[model samples]
Target: MATLEIDLFTARSDNFGVLLHDPETGRTASIDAPEQAPILAALERRGWTLTDIFTTHHHQDHVEANMALKDRFGVTIVGPGSEADRIPGIDTSVGDGDSFDFAGHRVEVIETPGHTAGHICFYLPEDKLLFSADTLFALGCGRLFERPAEVMWPSLLKLRALPADTTVYFGHEYTLSNARFAVTIDPDNAALTARAQAIETLRAKGRPTAPTLLADEIATNPFLRADDPAIRAHLGMEAAEDWQVFAEIRARKDRF
Candidate 1:
């Protein structure tokens, strides 16, 4: 089967509105609905009818347009099973390790519950695409609003184990700021320093850095590198477990 065509645009604030279209079936799915107007405008631009919504979590900014879009396009909304009660207009509920179909491709649901208790991410193994709304960002992970560091660290491991080439589509545009913080934690990483310089250029040009390579994130993102010796040493936790190191990094970020 052909991979789904992707469309990404800025929505309310820094939120990224994404649309995935299957050319073979003429069916399109919105990764999340942050705003009604932008989504409608994007659909109009591509002349694609909205067929479904693959919700990542129950955050307001990520799902506020759910009912409106569903009402207008009669879209079927699929969301995390654990937080289905919180997702507006959720028609189908799925959880960790669940796989569903969109067009002829398999959409694997990975439950990442750090940002929220029932937060999830969508991964298409065939296409190596991961819609990691709020769970994993370009250079950072989401804040733990509903869970703690221990719970979130394992959730991150699930994503880390994915293919290195997986193209990650994050929900927000905080790469520039996250990069600024990253250098402080993993200062000696040459790859990270180079990536930060590039991000600085991208932000200066007003470009979006949503789709980052998982390999780059693994090499630089402090939250994902708690097990790395350099970061653990930076935090003065060389003997600590990975999750404990992650907690220290998160604590520092919360203050940063």
Candidate 2:
């Protein structure tokens, strides 16, 4: 079987709203709505009406445009059940272990409550694609906002356990900035150097460094390498908890 066609829309500057389509069944759904104009324009360009909107969290950047777009397109809004109260206009509330169909594709909702108490990432096992909100980023993870570092660590581990082939579509285009910080701590990481160079090249051309594969991330991303001996040693801490490393990395990024 071939992978389902996933079209990415770079809406609201750095935020990305994805479109999942299955030509066989002619079904299409969008992942999130950070802004209204760009998502509407993308849908119009493809002549596709928004059938469903899956929100990862209640962050304004992720769900602010939900009502405007829903009213404009008559779309079904789905969001994390744990955060239904915060996610405005959610018609269907989902939780961990829940599954839904989109264009003949089955998507599993993975509860990742670190970026937010209700943050949930949609995972398509068949396609090995994870619409990881702000929980897991290219070179870093989202800041510990409403939750503590310990609470966020397990959430990110859930994502790291997925198949390495999963294509991670994150919420922001903060790669270059994050990579710069990663190199400072893991200066000997040849992969990080290479990826930084590539990212620099891509950004210089005004290109997007998105839809990055999880496999590449595992090899190069420091946030996902808390267990690595090299990283543990560099942190000047032994027997450190996963969240400790996560905290260190996030703290560094904040200062960087």
Candidate 3:
């Protein structure tokens, strides 16, 4: 199996644009074309040509450069079928449980529709990599823009059920701010405290705190800790359903 090489770079403020390349087949894809300049630059730096684009949602920031890149490289644009009307230049539409082949690798689409009614995430089982997009962030999850917390909580749990070693790449650089809110809720978490310190150090040095491991997220990310007894206890929701606990956490983050 050929290893997937990922190049992650910042685009348009806090958004992250990622390029996934397969060395063996020389096929490359952009996870989301948040902007044309950075995505094009990353492709140029690696001497790779963009052949496909995997869009997670219909948000303008995530798809703003899709048409530009497609016109330049004639790339195939893949996005959620649920939001086909909203995604520009989308050639292929997929929903949860749909699987497809990309540059000799299989990609699984997981529908996560809290942030948007049609949001989806890509999971590459072969590489153990997940492109979580806006659904799940470092220490926090995306705000419930199109659906209620009840709907979004299950989507998060789905991502959390992936292999422990799965490398998670999310949409933005909100880890530092998320860490601040996380500590306020789960103050006694030693792992979270350590993770918070590390996030601060990385931010100070101008580093990206993404591509985090699912194991670490499960251990430290408060959004993913809804099932944790400690978190429930702290929230005084010991008897609450997992989704209820999750809703409270998300609500707190909204106001944080």
**lDDT values for all models:** 0.93, 0.84, 0.93
Error of 3 at 174 (Å): 0.2
Where is the poorest 10-residue window by lDDT in model 3? 217-226
Clashes of 3: 0
Candidate 1 deviant stretches above 4 angstroms: none
If ranked by lDDT, best first, what sequence of candidates would result?
A: 3, 1, 2
Angstrom error of the Cα, residue 43, model 3: value is 1.0
**What digit string (tens of lDDT, one per residue) describes model 2 on residues 1-256?**
4356777778776887788767666566788889988877877787777778989999999998889978877888889998999987899999999998877678999998877888999999988889997988888788878888788888888888899989899888898898888888788889999999899888899888888999888888888887778887888856887778878877887789
TM-score of each model, paired residue for residue:
0.99, 0.95, 0.98
Candidate 3 Cα outliers beyond 4 Å, as residue runs: none
Q: What C-alpha lDDT does candidate 3 achieve relative to the native structure?
A: 0.93
Q: In candidate 3, residue 109 scores what lDDT? A: 97
What CA root-mean-square deviation does each model show from the true structure? 0.7, 1.4, 0.8
Write candidate 3's Cα lDDT for 110-130 as tens digits.
Answer: 999899999999999989999
lDDT of 1 by residue, 1-256 (tens): 8768999999999999999999989899999899999999999999999999999999899999999999998999999999999999999999999999899899999999899999999999999999999989988899999999999999999999999999999999989999999999999999999999999999999999989999999988988999999888878999999999998888888788
